[model samples]
Target: MDTTALEFSLPNAAAEPDPFSIADLSPEIRFAVLFFQRDHYCTNCREQVQAVADRVDAFRARGAEPVSVVPEPLDRVEQWQAEYDLPYPLLADEDAAVGDAYDQPVRFGLLGSVSDFLGRMPQIVVLDRSGGEGDPEVVYTYSSNSTFDRPSIDELLATLDDLAADGETTSTDG
Candidate 1:
């Protein structure tokens, strides 16, 4: 997928996120790590988010900001904000358009298509904005195969480290 072509503006639940659109990202943010959640009630998703919250500083050290996208209403995402108090951005993708644009996985044919909880798997997309003044590009992508299948914070850090090591490592199969 050409991530450069994707654009979305969501109601941010946490603080200002610089909003992941086609426009150029802020100068400080080298990479935008987008976490496509499975659903509002997935325990794994909750744990994963908490884990990210714990190691957010590590991500910042690497010039990466982790953003969680929940395919639910604003109120739902607000509840997440109240619970996690995430330092980074937590977005409310009410219609799941952004997730769809990024092609967030849906495992169960009909059931998954109808319900995000049943079908939607996790996706971790790393957008590289190191190319200053230009729109950030999708440098790495990780679409989970199952509910509990997702990348660890360390692994995500490694990918960002790799991105810094050499520019433009585009891999959709991550």
Candidate 2:
């Protein structure tokens, strides 16, 4: 895949720029852990959000920044931020364009496409951008088959560790 389409700009709950763009991140952020939510009402999505929040530091420690993308409007996303106070970026993909770009699957075909709650699944995309230039590569992607399915944070950390061990670490102190 070209992967260029993955880049996007959306409203953010915690960012100096107010609106957050995935293309803009710390130089030290070699990996961007994009947690794509199904919707605001998803219990699994909420738990995953908090889980990522709890371990945002660990992700940063491994040269990764966890970003939660809620496929809802700005107001709904703000409510989540007010409740969880996520330490990392909380983006509102209001039109779900980003999710579709990343190929977040629709299980039941046309029926599933009608409602995000009944069909849209969770996804995690780890984008690797080792330097200040170039498009972030899609290093890792996990698309949930079921609503309740999700990989543990430890598993994601291990993936980062493995990537670093394989000499793919591109994080720099610029």
Quick one: best lDDT, which candidate?
1
Please give the range of 10 consecutive residues that has the lowest summed lDDT in model 2: 165-174
- The residue pairs that clash in candidate 2, if any, are none
TM-score of each: 0.91, 0.90
Model 2 accuracy (lDDT, Cα):
0.81
Candidate 2 wrongly placed segments (more than 4 Å): 3-5, 167-174
Error of 2 at 132 (Å): 5.0
Q: What are the per-model C-alpha RMSD values against the true structure? A: 2.1, 5.0
Instruction: List ranges where model 1 is wrong by over 4 Å.
Output: 1-5, 17-25, 172-174
- Candidate 2 has a TM-score of 0.90
Model 1 residue 166 CA deviation in Å: 0.7
Candidate 1 residue-wise lDDT at 149: 83
Candidate 1, 43-127: lDDT as tens digits: 8998988999999999999988888998899899889889999888888888888999888998789998898878888898888
Model 1: per-residue Cα lDDT at residue 74: 85
